[model samples]
Target: MPHGKPGQAGSFTLGPASGDVNTAYRYRLTSGSFDSGWSAYKPGATATIAPVPPTSGTMVLFAEAKDNYAAGAANSVEFVVKEGDGPVARWNFAETSGAALDTSTTDQSLRDNAALAGGAVRTDRGRRGEVTVTRATETTPAVKSTDSGLKLNGTTDYAVTSGPVIDTRASYTVAAWVRMDVPTRNATVFGQKGVNRSPFYLGYEHTSKKWSFREVNTDAAVGTPFSYQRVESKRPAVPMVWTHLAGVFDAVNNTISLYVNGELQGTTPFTTAWAATGPLQIGRVHWSSVYSDYFPGVIDEAAVWQEALTDTQVAEESELIDAHAVPSVELVTAWTPAGAQGTTLRDTVSGYGSDLALSSGASLADDELVLNGTTGAGTTAGPVVDDSGSFTVTTQAVVDAAKILSKPDGYKAQILGQRTATGSSWSLWFEKTGTRQEPELDENGDRIVDENGNPRTTPVPVGRWHFGRLTADGTGASVESMEEALMDTETRLTGVYNARHRTIQLYLTSDQQASDGIAYTAQVGTGELAVGKGYLGSWANFLPGRLSDIRLWAGALSDSKQVSDVVGT
Candidate 1:
């Protein structure tokens, strides 16, 4: 849009999209009824509307691409005519020096007064912003800003707003880009402090293991059971990824909604709402006469609005992270050069000081470790393996059938695992020649009879590959793929624990797909991660093979191409 002085006739150009894409445009007053129906989509075409943008109040310019398919999410820019500018307060954390400035409004009172405590430091790794509010008070059009965010160190790190930003008793909306590093406990993205319980909170709820929006019905420190009402997302929150969360309190509708990414996840009806007054705490919650649930992650573009943002408004904000952007990933460790640091296998990822100590019983050659079924193994030497909820482990190895040491039932060979005295956090191994119990069948599929008239039975051979995992709640299960292609061949095996889906996937070589992954979750055990062997009770299930490479990622590598690339087709 071309802008001149506010009073001059307004002239806006709907230019052809880049890459010669076809685009359409429309405009309407956010609070008024002047609507320009979507213009015809055409490449290199221009469209003009007789009505100019509102000289006051608010106007929205909506644009959508019309190529072979929708190129991206519809983008709408809000141009508002306001006194001080747009949001009540905005913390971009983009400052190179001095306190981070609040750029949305000019009111000195509403400026950035949040204090960074503990290890909360400004970081350049933040979301790719896609929306920015343009106010008529500005001399130029608004441009989206992609800037740094505050990294909260989970234990004591946080940003405390000097004072409350919005009236919690009334309808309001609050949002931020949150990248959770871990979900060991309930974590807060933003929480309004009060005498006791905060009036509203948006973050991961420990009970449900889901992103949640919490609102209390009373302002008093002591409240009835009905005072606490929360709406949790249908999907569990996956750690080590950046996500946009918006908590909307609609006093008019008597409902509270939580939006994940950009879409409304779930809404809960409330009987009443109360105001919480005090400083707004980012990355921590105060309640029960003590501060707790300090967030272990990063927060960016934290803002508050006095009004309940409509669905369109929320969707527009969701666009901050492009609809097509590849999901963000946090690499916890990558143990490369398997034998890089002399006798110890050094983790090549900088800042992550994980090294694997190959047992003296094992021999390293050509960056590969050869483990005998009885005497060889390698274990994580540093403080690794604490990523409990979601993780991926990929390895390339060849299992020698002879080393299976097949007992009467079968043999087990551990490829990777983190096990402690109490239970196994996760384990992947090959259960070779195990038998499946079933009724014996005669030629016609009928159960065969035994001498005493009891049904005859036979043991059926179960396939080799199996993955085992335990949830934080103590439940555990192991799933085996019945493909029967025993572990004798060199293959890439990728095990993924996606806490979001509550499932575990074992991916074999790219040429084939293991049916569906067995469902599983993660629990961090006290033991360090070990390759070639995992403990069941007495450090058993040793692998006798060449383990060429093994790498662990914090996020799930579920995408087909992602698996193929990481594991090699």
Candidate 2:
């Protein structure tokens, strides 16, 4: 039989009859001839038939009784058809050192065409790597078990090619299995673009930490600021871990939807006219002006579809990614990345204390260290809290500077940075010293006033305070805040390491209640967790603000109703 399940259908074909003039062929079963009659045989035309299997057991069919000629010997045949059509474009990323190939039926292949020569970064930690690709004894899905994946170094690594033009204004879906190194910045997963007013893009916003789907329409006129239509997930993506992401745009309904790990995140109405006419970029946006949106991390089984895949299909795709993920539950160390300026980075939980002094430029202002970005500040002991398995770390602070914390390795392991440099993480920031507003200017450079005869201009926000908590655990990582800052009372940011769930949860509140929060899978590394100042060599990472009441917990805090008691909410 062809290649189908017990109750599935299969198609069979018989060769064109030959051997004599006016010859014909008829097919039959062992019991009797089939009800469908056969006719004259042509030189090239073959008879095709589709039949559903009656039961699980095998069945045989016979062919070749010729017409106007002597009967020929019967030929037996079998047919089996499998269920489901595969992805339109699927990249297994099995190639370790060369171009990324498309394993889909479209033959749309992509080579390692990095725009910059030294841009592509190669690592051995792929899912199906030199060793991890081994198959399990149990019956696992083939797509999930196939080994190997690609990792993109945030700075420049990405895979690009042209030809697969999927219409964003029509029904379509895009999906991928992603493992982010640091989930910040406007990181693009995959997009096609060429400066055509508006294009389709799926990316994560570093400042908001939310997954977004955007369709641009530059032709929009005034009073329609909604020209840049988008549907953002209600929550942010967990940093430094693997997650399944899928976005579907249905033009008929003028709605867009996003899914994380097979769950429907949210759906919103969005109507816009846009087009994309550039090379299909895997890790970055195609527009040259916005190269900063390049994806930073590993992507596997990236795919695109001409039709919106049903929720069921997205669930199956998510399962494929989960099969390869191995959960970790070990706690390496936990500490708040904030302390007195010019002092040692003290550990609150594991007590893996470090006497490593900070750079002289670091100064204490109201108990928190103020870094000038150029000054070096961190623990002297390298890899102070190194753990091979898993870990959870949490800290809370109010920062005015944008690049609040970074590691020494050229800002490679940044802990937290402002979403927008001028603003704080949780609070609205206004520069300590700046004019709030000026007279509004017209196109002719003349001052314009409103109907009330006053300067018709909006107040420019110059500064704002920023505050929030940062968490990193085995399941994932995140920087979170309670939407706004609590001016009178301090907000508590809590991170819990649930090894059993192989995930980390983040909570933010001022009333000591761990209410609704975001959770993500964690990223594993041996690098030491630093605080206050990062990018030691460059002098570009310094808190320049205060850090207070930093503490840590040993493991996943018990799920007690009084969560605030453990880590003040």
Candidate 3:
């Protein structure tokens, strides 16, 4: 009878035309009774099949005989709405072409029959055509031993599984967050091929605690290493502290950049062109089976991109990382109140203005100010200002007071002196300043004089109005100076100070022509000096201008550099 019946009741099969069989046929859904007449099957045919709504339990399909049109031919298919209907399709990696490596085992396998009917395929896992790469996790190398609480042995090398291969000829950026149990040995974190078999790499070394970026030029008969720059952390990397690191190569600009904790720390130029072949590896050197310089730490959130990140993006990322790593702390500067003894105001500059008022019971003579758990004291004699207007005289005493007052145990002071036309050349002294005399003086007044009896007057030049900072640590101090004019000559002296009471007297001799004769000049002001006393002084005509910022510390500042920072010449 040469008769034909539907393959499956609901399934329809279209016949190809005698000559043109490649044309596609379209299908659409139609509204009709389940028992409607069968549609013709032909080339370029279009058919409409209505779907059974969920409310309907199931849909049955039957086929009518064709070719001679025989009736009552039993060809029917049934589909039921049951809990389990085997997956529509499964994927097999072995059957898939271009799969470099596939790791699927057990009855549910990537090679034999792995379900793909539900989700998209992972491209990196050699399953891209089906789905986009959504998420991935890279684990740190296993640890071998512990050195100073840091893992000592672990592989850092890795191979790109699948995705866009790194093109050295193109620009790219790489970033990662690392928490080393121990410092990394000089080793490669990441790198790829460049011109003449040269490779660009970002790495760190435990010995120096420095991170470096370099390019290897194998073009030389002997391989040549071209280092851009190495950045050493100002402070040593603490154990287990996660540090964020990043590197970027701009092929267009011929520049390479590096960032730490989102902060761009170093950059270099790449005059030579980059090659296009080598595989991307992390933690270990490329193509090396032995893992010697492996990173021994935890790494999270590593990323690579084809474009350089903007400075704003980098800063934002750095801030985000900092927030996650160290959070912020509230910083407050205040002063102790007068009459209340130890009571201190939350805001010293706010309540007392420029004058840090101490309680009457507080001893200004002690050269110290105790406020909010911080203690600061004066180092020299000039720091002392009595009820009487005159200041005691002594170069050593004045410098000492400046030092101690600059970084008081709990407070800091700013220099308010201006450049006087007097021929007396005084150098600004701080830790870094090359001035001869130490700003701090010992109990013996002889400290300022060298064996030669010279005044040790390499005047730390203070050309313009500026403030010097003195940071105190226990009995030591560090000094830093800042001024508006670059021509300002200032020396920094950082050293220890003794916060004892001593009167500062400014001497005016006719020949010296030093003193401007005002009984109470605007230049002098008073506040905390030593722990027990506060100072009050009137400049008179000696130097005109209101005393600006006066502060005292509870502890001694002994660092010579710190002292120089407190008062610049």
Expressed as tens digits, the lDDT of each residue in 1-569 for candidate 3 is 11111111134544333443222332322222435454454434433444322212244444333332333232444455332111122122223323213222234332222221112222111101111122223654322211111112455323333222355566666655444544535655565533333355666767866665555434332245443333443333433334556676767677777775555666667756446464444444442223345555533334555555544344333332211232111111123233333333223431212233433332322332332212232222122221111111111112233323223233322222211122111111222222222353457854465688755543332222111112123121222233311222212222212211111111111011112221221121222232222222321111111111233321222222222322222
| lDDT scores in order | 0.67, 0.50, 0.33
Among residues 3 or more apart in sequence or in different chains, the pairs in candidate 1 whose N, CA or C atoms overlap within 3 Å are 130-320
lDDT of 2 at 428: 14
- Candidate 2 vs. true structure, TM-score: 0.41
Best-fitting candidate, scored by lDDT: 1
lDDT of 1: 0.67
For model 1, give the 10-residue run with minimal summed lDDT: 128-137
Candidate 3 scores a C-alpha RMSD against the true structure in Å of 29.5
Top-down lDDT ranking: 1, 2, 3
Off by over 4 Å in 2: 1-85, 106-118, 127-147, 218-226, 287-290, 321-569
Candidate 3 residue spans exceeding 4 A from truth: 1-164, 193-198, 218-239, 287-292, 321-470, 473-569
lDDT of 3: 0.33
TM-score of each: 0.53, 0.41, 0.31
**lDDT tens digits by residue: candidate 1, 1-569:** 33432212344556555655656655554454425455665655765643443244456656554544555435556655332124576777777754656776787865756778777898755553222333224477645444467888889988887778777888788898777876788999888887777888799987788999988766555444535788888667766555678998888788999987666778889767777778888889887656889999788878887767766566555444232343333444566655454568776652345677888666777777778878688987422433334566777777765555343345667777877665467777766666556798888999988889999776554446666753233256766654774445777777776544557777776533445666664554656678888666667667787777677654456666556744464
Superposition error at 563 for model 1 (Å): 2.0
Query: Model 2 residue 337 lDDT?
Result: 42
Error of 2 at 271 (Å): 2.5
